[model samples]
Target: MNDQTKGIIAWIIIGLIAGLVASLIVGGAGSIIGWLIAGLIGSVVGGFLAQRFDIKLNLGNPFFEQVIVSIVGAIIVLIIAQIIT
Candidate 1:
């Protein structure tokens, strides 16, 4: 696989983890597609919020850090969704 392919796979893995964890924390219908969507969008929002807020998680492993950040972001997304719908 190429570098881009590897990166996409990594993101999917991280997103799955984050989405599952976030859903459990926030209460959501657990589904593969739901998790993927939440995780992907959460990753972007979380990365942006973290940068804007100067929040850096020193989780040692970069992948773990990404998952945690994504989870947090997903939680926020889920909460906003609940409010909207």
Candidate 2:
């Protein structure tokens, strides 16, 4: 697949996983769909936040950086969702 496609898949996976993790940490019901949504939203928010913080996301082989971004993004999403819910 292309880079964009790969990125989408990556985000979905990350979102799903992050959601589950966040929900567990927050002691809430586990919803894959919800997690996926949060993950997707988190991806966007995280990307923007990272950029604003001068933290660069690698489009290449830097896997760790991406993971960090995903986790941070997931955390942000969880926080927002907590407030909204």
Candidate 3:
């Protein structure tokens, strides 16, 4: 697979994981697609926040660190959403 394709697949995987975890934590009753979308958005949010705050996970593995970050972001998004509505 090409680099771009691999990146897309990685993003999707990260999103799915982050979304599911966030749903469980936030008691989400949404659909799979919804979680996926949320997770995707969470990844972006997490990345932005991480960049701004200089957050880094020295877990020796980039993927796992990203998953954690994405999960946190998803949770933040879910919480903010709950408050907004």
Candidate 4:
């Protein structure tokens, strides 16, 4: 696959993992579509937070790094959703 395809696939995987973990932690629930939405949004949020706060992971694996960041971001998203609802 091309670089774009790879990146998209990576993001999906990261989103699934992050969404599930965040939902579990925050006592939120969702379907596959919900998880995907949360995960994608989480990825963006995580990236922004990392850039703003200089968050870094020395996991030596980009996938793991993304997962960790995504999870944190997803948690924040869940909290906001809770507050808003």
Candidate 5:
């Protein structure tokens, strides 16, 4: 696998984990695909919000940091989804 492939895989793993955790925390129902979608969306939104809000989280690990941000973002997405639907 190339660097891009590795990155994609890493992202998928992070997304899946973040989605699962977010769903559990925010209370959501869906399949693996749903979780993945939520996770990916959350990742983007979370990163953007983190930057916009100046949220600084130094977890000492890049991967863990990503997961934490992703989870927080996913929770936000889930909450919005719940309100919308």
Candidate 6:
């Protein structure tokens, strides 16, 4: 797949994983679809945070960057979810 396709898939996977993890940590009030949305948003937040912190995996592609970004994004989402609920 092309970089964009890979990136999209990567974000979806990351979103699902991150959402699941968040649900596990926080408990309930979440679904796969919700997590998916959270994950996508998280990636954007993660990217912003990563850029601010100068953190990068340097895998030489947006995919790696997105992966890193998603992890951060997941964490942010988790925290927000925890706080909101």
lDDT (CA) per prediction:
0.90, 0.70, 0.90, 0.87, 0.91, 0.72
Per-model RMSD to reference: 0.9, 3.0, 1.0, 1.0, 0.9, 3.2
The residue pairs that clash in candidate 4, if any, are none
Superposition TM-score, candidate 5 onto the true structure: 0.94
Q: After superposition, how far is residue 50 of candidate 1 from its true place, in Å?
A: 0.5
**Per-residue alpha-carbon lDDT of model 3 for 13-83, expressed as tens digits?**
99999999999999673888978987998998998899899998899999999999999899889988888
List TM-score per model, in order: 0.95, 0.71, 0.93, 0.93, 0.94, 0.65
lDDT at residue 38 of model 6 (Cα atoms): 71
> By lDDT, who's the top model here?
5
The superposed Cα distance between candidate 2 and the true structure at residue 52, in angstroms, equals 0.2
lDDT of 2 by residue, 1-85 (tens): 8999998787678777766666666644357787777666766787789889988756676555665576677777787777889
lDDT digits (tens) for residues 4-81 of candidate 5: 999999999999988989999888847798789889889999999999999989989999999999999999999999
Clashes of each: 0, 0, 0, 0, 0, 1
TM-score winner, 4 or 5: 5
Question: What's model 4's TM-score?
Answer: 0.93
Give the least accurate 10-residue stretch of model 4, judged by summed lDDT.
27-36
Candidate 4 residue lDDT tens string, 1-85: 8999998898898998888888888867478777877878888899899989997898999889989999989889988988999
| TM-score: the better of candidates 1 and 2 | 1
Deviation (Å) of 56 in candidate 5:
1.8
Residue 69 error, candidate 3, Å: 0.6
